[model samples]
Target: MASIANKVYLFDRDKNLQWTSSIDNLEDVAISADGNKIIAVASNKVYSLLVDAPEEKFHFPVGYPDAEWYEHESPNGQGWMTYNPEPPCYGYHLGDDWNAKPPPDYDDYGDPVYAVASGMVVYAKTVPGDVWWGNVIMIRHDNINGTGVITSMYAHLRDINVSEGNVVGSGQVIGTIGKGYDDKLPSHLHFEIRYGDSETVGIGCIDSELVSGEQGPQGQIDPTWFINTY
Candidate 1:
């Protein structure tokens, strides 16, 4: 099957058009392993069609389901988004910078960072002398809503509570916020959601065309939007 513009086309082994479905704003399409279903991503939502239906699937990184948190523009207390993923001179940010809501400074230092969803911890360690990423943890989530594998990264952590191969549950405590190895930036958590490769610890930023608003280049997406959507 192939998706073009606002439609999805189904073809047989001879490459002849079998059928087509009109799905507005279609972005991607995939056939299930048994060829009994079709999964389509459109307008930031997942559609599961019965090869005949369609359907859909954030817990949050710092708090539980009922925890009150804000992003970049919080008017309430101790947490807000400090920086959004955007293309800067250094390259695309590739993640969101979340800090305590108020009193600023290092007040949020040592605060616990939770896993946004259940997944296997792929990387959990500090890169010696790397000031940008103090202690970091990466979790690989597989077959999410039939969207395939995606990796969540937490950086500038003060403490790492999980190992490289441990399977963590959603909202599990994994680390604490920190001020990077060099103590240059204030206390905050640099969170990222990477698509495709789950093992590589990317440079955190890259030079490429921006997509879907402030979303970084390929391999990275808007973390806040992703959490709110999925």
Candidate 2:
């Protein structure tokens, strides 16, 4: 699979022009089954458009921070994660274990955190004791079209800038990378694009897994899709 940073070709069979998009330096990638619907993260928000749909079809809002804190029942106690999927070149700590404490250069955290997609700040918290995910923010992206999309989460932040209910623009700055609370690894952002609702999603910073219920999903969606579209 291609890393999120590489540019991909989008062929609009019905349309004449072939559009090209790059995912380099972007946050996430979203694509419809046939490669028609496209959404990609630029800075703090996502940009999206359907081949047959008008510009109004682009639904992601600008800025918003996390309002409430999420406490999941985990066997290892409460923890959070960062999802920086820029391939093995950037942000990715491939052989590095999530449970290992970051080296001295990254003791405090590294890299400023940006929003994956624009939306309202619905949940934010900076509790001291979290082991895997330190400071966290979860924004709810509005998908009014009922395309089956909702909030996206930015976890393990070193600092959060906005509060709850605030509206932010696409590609806005929300936070910075901090020492992860639970993972205890390098400072990086954990990004998750939630479909339908929360409570069910993937896990781990690297070796990303699709977590649905007690079991993880079978395959990983090409991160390239979400990173390229925005």
Candidate 3:
């Protein structure tokens, strides 16, 4: 539970330092509404780390089969470059507006987005709009005590496969990644988990007292409780 700053770090369950290094700038630190799980966003990839997995080593540059876009700048300001940081492959970072003329295809957005765990759908939105987050969904899960309970969320969906009031099982397909509501950024899913009611979901407002408060509509839970870190 150390403050999530710009660096990527590893720690033991006792909060002892295990390893540390600089990834891309840390965008956000999402803890499952429960207190046991965490997902940190660094540039294009999401790193899921669990407090339960304190003894194992975790590294970035997820070894996916394909290389995604990443930004890098020249030392002398010649220009920005786009490259795959994945080893054995040499890619460069493209400038900020590199894809302004020809953007990535819709199909570039990948397949089925799944539920992190079994839960009840408390909120789901499918229509297009101007919000920073496009289509979004929120679910509530009952976790064991000590971690309290949690609420899971998925956003920026191209398609919503589930509806409000629906009960879903773990790994259920809920949506697909799509363009941001602004149509500027590429297709990506803005997934999150909070520990309170549906209204507090995805608002980026982390509130304490969720565990002790009356389970109201705006409470929050950390997101780390459900994600499996490997």
Candidate 4:
């Protein structure tokens, strides 16, 4: 089976067109009885049809950073990450790390942090501890042409300009970079995207798995993947 232009087409293994269904906006689906019936998902509504096996929708074009920002602190090869635990904190780290540290430039403190895409601000607050993300912002994007729901988070912020339930536009300045109470750390933005509600630590949030060793938010997607480049 395949989908095109909001329609689902069923094909036999022999490449023959078995049937077709006119779907308005397919969000998800499930099938049963050895491809005899299918449950088509269209947001709040679900439909049941005969003759089909379950199929998952592909997320195409993915999502690029719709926000306007200065620059990436760490590039591809010159980055650090914890996603891969070989050495732990492997790669370049989850955040694109725009305007990052090492030089401790005080002027960088108020550097503006922009929303990578248009969405509702779901969270913003301060978390305790210099290790955990101190100041943070989380935004939940509504359905994008049935592309599935996702969330974006900005951490280690110094200032938050948006509140919960606030709809923010792509490239809008939601806050400034801050290091929270970590006096030893320079102000830099730690950002990431999650598959769902994910998780947050009231004052802010943290991926326990990334820190300790328990299962954490479904996982963290590299923020660089969403960044738009000219």
Candidate 5:
């Protein structure tokens, strides 16, 4: 498999083209040893498809059944988001800080963090001496209806249930929410949706640099928009 000019091409042993991906901005491509599956990475997402079937889906990283969770919208209101990308505290918030509603502060601690989609765990480890990220897990999901690949990152986790290279199913519990390294800051899940590279564990946020206009930093997208759209 090879990706060039935003296209992915699959060829048989004879080098004859067997299939061409309809998606664009594909940065890399790989095939399983058995040649039964193909995984491709785009500028802001990743996609994998079976040789015989092609489909993808996504889910919320927190909450169960109905995903009864909400993002931190304001510092004055209940739940997380004391600092955001918007005014007041104009920090370069790259992702959404998810929190369970009602009776905030440590109430949601240790809550299970789920895999938003079926994919391989590309990165999972606790950052040593880093109080902002704590435990982080990144899952790379294949193309969503031919829209390229997407990665889901869960941070500030209390416990990591899944390891790197594990293929997890959508909604599978991968970890539990927690405060940072030394339990600094209030308990909440700092979640992000990154594209392109799946192995890089980016700084949760930055004070400078905007990747997508004023939306977010480079390689990151709005977690709320991604969850609702996909």
Candidate 6:
């Protein structure tokens, strides 16, 4: 049981004080339904800390601790940015097609794909040509500002380094870029984050836009806002 002024404390099932932190203007305590992370929402920002990890901290899946990539915009008419490089449009297509792409070598073959955070590999599959996202990997995060059972998914890979039920550390290389398609759709990583029992697989994934209120909570989060992409 450790805490400081304006701090939030987390307890384990055994009633042990697992983790705690001090925050300014600590607001309501939000617990993940899985009880893996505890979020402390302050006045201006949010704090996400892992519960089981005593010495390790959560990190961005890409571009941190010596990793970088050229962030691309959705040219296929997904103008609205999302964690997933490719946006699966929902309802009807309003603008142009959703299969947008960047210039050549934007995402080359064998481009390294990384695990967004340290978590257990709940789902992993490698089936090239079976679907647009030839290979898919879903990782359930330990905690993100107390967001419970949040998941990060990587798709359209040519190779998969990890398998199901494997425990991976943050920033660990799990796969590589596969054929992202022709010039219309370059080889890039299709990534996304989900909360709760949301659909990790990108099977016809057409999520609604920001604050559009058209889609459910399956994954309304913008990955760019959650991670340190810049």
Collision count for each candidate, in order = 10, 40, 31, 19, 7, 5
lDDT of 1 by residue, 77-147 (tens): 33333333333325555677776555444377888888776556779998666667778899876666565
User: Which residue runs of candidate 1 sit more than 4 Å off their true CA positions?
Assistant: 1-57, 73-89, 103-106, 213-218
TM-score for every candidate vs. truth? Answer: 0.64, 0.44, 0.44, 0.52, 0.68, 0.56
Give the residue spans of candidate 6 off by over 4 A. Answer: 1-60, 63-67, 76-107, 127-130, 180-185, 198-217, 228-230
lDDT of 3 by residue, 1-230 (tens): 44446865667789899656455666654444333455555553345555463332111111111113421222223222222112111231111111111253434354556666545666788534446566777766554233345666666567878776665544556776666565544554544545544533334322322343233234432222223331
What is the Cα-based lDDT of residue 58 in candidate 2? 23
Model 3 worst lDDT run, 10 consecutive residues: 58-67
Q: In candidate 2, residue 195 scores what lDDT?
A: 46
Top candidate when judged by TM-score against the true structure: 5
Order of quality (lDDT)? 5, 1, 6, 4, 3, 2
Residues 1-230 of candidate 5 have per-residue lDDT tens digits of 67678777888889999888677665555554334567665554446645565444466777753468655665544335522464333556677787787664438888898887666788899876665678899887766545466778888889999777666666678899898677876788888887654677767657774644344443687777666777
lDDT of 6: 0.53
Assess each prediction's global lDDT (C-alpha) against the native.
0.66, 0.45, 0.46, 0.53, 0.69, 0.53
Better candidate number, 2 or 4, judged by TM-score: 4
Q: Could you give candidate 6's per-residue lDDT for residues 1-230 as a string of tens digits?
A: 33456877777669888666777776444443234555444563335556463433345443443334445455445333343334444432211111223474353567666666566676788644453556778876654445566777776666889877665656678887655333234455666656554434644344433344333345545555455432
What is the C-alpha lDDT profile of model 2 across 1-230, one tens digit per residue?
Answer: 12236564555556555667665556555453223456555554455534464322222111122211221111232132222323442233211112223353434354445454445566777644546657767666656344345556666666788775555444567776666675465544455554444432234434443332221131222222333343
